[model samples]
Target: MARAHRYTVEVTWTGNTGTGTSGYRDFSRDHEVRGDGKPVLPGSSDPAFRGDPGRYNPEELLVAALSQCHLLWFLHLAATAGVVVTGYTDRPEGTMTENADGAGEFTEVVLRPAVTVADPGMVDAVPGLHERAHQMCFIARSVNFPVHHQPSTSAADSAV
Candidate 1:
């Protein structure tokens, strides 16, 4: 039987600027996100929507979640397969399309992972491991858009 897990977060709007939503440009888009035992996350709309560029946006967070889930699953599978991972990093990107009504949806996300392994012989197995990790990622499975992977691997001593 599968077990259920729950996650809860509280979002507080901190952008009242003396008046609340009095006009289109009167309020800010800044907000605070908090979870139990976690540091408060500063959040805002994308800068294109008049939000502060320094704060985290929802679209960026979505891409990060996908990347993080894939990374954890990949590491676990590598350990189980006896492939020693030395270092790993990913720069993932997501594409979204907005409609005339100002609504938007993500079309796709690409995960580019650069991995370094301890042994040269393990390099060839890394791509297949990434495939398995994509198949197992919870965020990827939950998304309506496509998640593509482009992975590169190198032996530890030769890694840059």
Candidate 2:
């Protein structure tokens, strides 16, 4: 049987510069994303779209969501497979193409994960674990674009 999960987030715009939307550049694309009992996330459009470069944008958030999902699933699978992972880090990148009409969609996302295992014996199993994690990632399954994983595994220092 399948289960359904619902998520809710509230976004409040805070960029009304007095005369709201009076012109093309009248308002800022600043907003706050709030979830129950969570810290407010500052949000804005991409800097190319006249947004604040200091704030997080929707495109970046999407990529982060994908990366986070994969990481969580990878850890869970690693634990269940008896692979002791000492450290894991990812530098995920996403590519988006904009149309002539100023609309865009993500083309692909590449997840570059560097994993350190507790033993050399676990190194060989890391690649298969990443594959399984990708197969099980909900975010990767939900997206239309391709999600690629390039993983590297290293054994932790036994002396430490």
Candidate 3:
């Protein structure tokens, strides 16, 4: 088998909650990010010091990674099966609950995918496709949390 792909990122902290010193990390981007300020991304209206919003949070990123991975796999499978997937969108929600140590953790996550398939019967394969996607999803397999998919859809108007 061929070697798997790899990725790398570096983060740095500058302040502590004790002295009220604000901190920022370099995502290798031109700008910096702060945990206590508003998100730096354009249109990010967070009250925190111009931070980029919650999308940059670790837990949220994990959920998004899983959702994106599943979508990619589903699209690949659909293409191979001669199914035309026109549009795809999903709202993946991650729930944070208290763990045994009294710390909050993402105990559950739900992925609601709205897929447009060419054939109406293709909707029935959503469950199976999701299962297979989950099996191949690297992020889902790496976490201990329970991830569920609540899928709904409409028929694709035309094949592209």
Candidate 4:
């Protein structure tokens, strides 16, 4: 049997100056993203495209989605496998290449996850979990580019 899931969001542009899009740099690249019952997400273009560095950009959001999706799926798998996960963190990176025509695309994304587990016996098992996560992560499966993983793990009692 097949099932379908739908996700929706609203993005409101808030960058209109006195004159909207009158010039190449007239408006801010600011916006608000909203989902039902969720806090409004502040968003903008990448700073390289004349956006505010303090705000969240689409590129960064994509990377965050990938990281979060993998973490969630990994946790689920660990629970089923008795891995006893205690902590997890990921510092993800992406590469976007822009042509002279102002068109761009993400070439790759690297997920660097450091995990902590309750059992040192689980350390050897942690490495293979990333491959399973990639197979299960919706974000990773949806992206056109390859998503690479580099994971490190340690027992909760030991320092990485």
lDDT of 2 by residue, 58-102 (tens): 999999999999999999999999999999899999999999999
Per-model TM against the reference: 0.96, 0.96, 0.68, 0.97
10: Cα error in model 1, Å: 0.9
State residue 86's C-alpha deviation in candidate 3, in Å.
0.5
Candidate 4 on 52-125: residue-level lDDT in tens? Answer: 88889999999999999999999999989889999999999999999999999999999999999998888887
Off by over 4 Å in 2: 157-160
Output the number of the lDDT-best candidate. Answer: 1
Against the reference, the lDDT scores of all candidates come to: 0.95, 0.93, 0.68, 0.92
Q: Which residue runs does candidate 3 get wrong by more than 4 Å?
A: 14-55, 99-102, 156-160
lDDT per residue for candidate 1 within 91-126, as digits (tens), equals 999999999999999999999999999999898889
Local accuracy of candidate 3 as per-residue lDDT tens digits, 1-160:
8788876443444223354333443221123344444444222212233445632555556778889988999888878877777779999998877567756668888988888987887777766777788888878888899988987767856322
lDDT of 1 at 136: 97
Say which prediction, candidate 3 or candidate 4, comes out ahead on TM-score: 4
State each model's C-alpha RMSD to the native.
1.3, 2.2, 7.2, 1.1
Candidate 1 lDDT: 0.95
Predicted structure 2: lDDT = 0.93
